[model samples]
Target: MRLHILGICGTFMGGVAALARELGDVVEGSDANVYPPMSTQLEALGISLKQDYRAEHLQPAPDLVVVGNAMVRGNPAVEYMLDRQLRYISGPQWLGEKLLADREVLAVAGTHGKTTTTSLLAHLLESAGLAPGFLVGGVPGNFGVSARLGQGRHFVIEADEYDTAFFDKRSKFVHYRPRIAILNNLEYDHADIFPDVAAIQRQFHHLVRTVPGNGRLIVNAHDAYLAEVLAMGCWTPVETFGIGQGDWRATLVEADGSVFTVHRGDELIGEVSWPLLGNHSVMNALAALAAAVAAGADPRVLLPAFATFESVKRRMEVVGEIGGVRVYDDFAHHPTAIAATLAGLRAKVGKARILVALEPRSNSMRLGAHAQALAPSLADADAVIFLHRPELPWDARHVTDALNGRGTTAASVDALIASLRDQAQAGDHVVFMSNGGFEGAPRRFVDALRP
Candidate 1:
């Protein structure tokens, strides 16, 4: 089958394209914004990629059109497809109907940590000889490719709460129908789509409704929003995980979250010392472990895999360390995730200066939904450079002012990098945080730091 995917540069859509190509389908795609890891992966697969959503790209009309959530009604390609009455389906629906139907699907879903948890779960299962197929949101360091069709019957996916497409308002995870689902943690996000936290929880409950009675739900024990979600209604067996609470627990052996001991109820599983930092990461590890056990992998066998597990790209990825200064590229847009990441780094570095280069790029951030909480989230950072682009509809000064003399605003990526370089010192850790391609600011800053 020949398939044309719209907005294929997105991580999830790109994974779908990779799976389609692996299934012997002729896959070609187009996107308005194409960059980095996802684009690189697609190129390596030898799939054809066209820039932008021009109507000309869909002229020949492939066997089917897989529309990404980013696609809207007014997009040139979308309008053309609709006018011609071309057969079309959302990426999530296509993936569910075609690839995941026969597999023992294990879905990792939440507002955060979904990528890492999904990657870790797949890795644990793979290490234990399960050979599970997976479609991670980012390029996991352990597996260079984001998606694959494995020999085993299990398929692990990073399930998202985002709507399937402009045409399909239902959350993407509703279509996955996984036997094992992890509700990592939930908070208010995606301000463009969801009106409030309760609305998002409603969608999560929809996903909950799809899991069979025999399936299992791996939940965060400390997350009040998720607890409320379960209160809505639950049919599957529930297993919770947290640092000091829940069915599966972790004890912080290291303040930076690099080392932790796992517990499954009264029984001690083992200690896991890994490179990932932050309490959020520990929670992710515990969730993955519980989910793996649910899928029939022994915890003892999976413990060793943690030592070798490499996290997904751009999730606190160290791009460079030069002249005693370490630079990290992170995909953290929400206030909660930002605070957790900074706190972990603060613990690791002690009194060392921590500088942050933040880009308010996500739909929520750009819309000023998280403005009031942004400054408080950066409390751990010694100094911060916020990229306050003119196109952003909100006044960034509100956030900067609340930083208590620690925050400064830059109008462009270049300015942001320069400000960080000026403030950075030896033994300092500089983190670049954003969900989108911040105009290649992270690597550019690393290059600038090169004396």
Candidate 2:
């Protein structure tokens, strides 16, 4: 089969392209903003890339055109596919039909924690020598590739709730047909599409509807939202996990550096001392263990892998650190994600002055919801700096006063950079948190702080 993928430079699309090649399908793709990582990866895989979308690029009609969600309607390639009546499938749809079919899939689904949980599960399986093939939204340091084709039948996937492509408005996870699905905490997100939390819940309900009767649904017992979903009746059996006692429980056993431990339902189900720390991370590990168990891997097999598993590329990725000031970048744009990220850094860095550089970039955050929680989330930090661009409607003055009232110094990043340029203090952690790349804030932070 020949596959022409649109917007193939994204992490998800890159994985799809790789899967196509591994399955012996001739692959070609195009993206407008092609850059490192994906570009280098695609070339290494020997897949051809078209810089721009053109009707001619679809020459001779590939067997299927996998369209990325980022490629919206009216795109030349998309329109051409439709006008010519050429069959097209979304990236997720293609993956489900071509790769995941007949495989035991362990899917991690939630408004948050999908990437972390998927990486943890993949690494956990690897620790047990399961060597499961996996696909994650972000690049897991443990595995060089976002998606890999391997010998194992157990496939771990980061199942997201975001709607699929422009044509298919259903959530992407609906197609994965998870044999073991982890329902991590659900919340109101993607405000641009989902009007409220209930709407998101409905999409999750759809995913639950598809799980096979013998499949397992691992849910956060503490999430009242998920509780409502389960109360509605499920076709598959459900297992619950949380900080408190349940079928599977999350207990923080220990922490040193990035590694941490979890005690499942009173028994120590091995340690997860990852390069991550937080209640949310604890939840992520719990979900991974549950899914691993469902996939026939021992829950205890993940401990060693957890220690060596570096987090995903942008989720708390430390670009560089100079002197005592450390700069971090993370793809945390939602309110819950931002709060969790700040909390994790606070736990790791101790009492160092934490300066938060944030961009309100996601569909939900770009508008506003955590207006109140924003200051408190950063309250652990000594100072907070917001880098609002010209178009975003965020009012820095309100955020400034809120943090100031909470006894934290607040300023704009541009201003903070100018003020801190002379010298970086001995104990300071500059944590830059955002879903979108903050236009080199990590680099700029180093340049401004280096003495």
- The 0-to-1 C-alpha lDDT of every candidate, in the order given, reads 0.93, 0.79
lDDT of 1 by residue, 323-429 (tens): 88899999999999999999988988899999999999999999999999999999999888899988989899999888889889999998888888888888999
Best by lDDT: 1
Per-candidate clash tally: 0, 4
Q: TM-score for all predictions?
A: 0.99, 0.92
List clashing residue pairs in candidate 2.
Answer: 258-274, 259-273, 259-274, 260-273
Query: lDDT of candidate 1 vs native?
Result: 0.93
Off by over 4 Å in 1: none
Candidate 2 per-residue lDDT over residues 358-377, each given as its tens digit: 77767777777666667666
Model 1, position 391: C-alpha lDDT score: 90
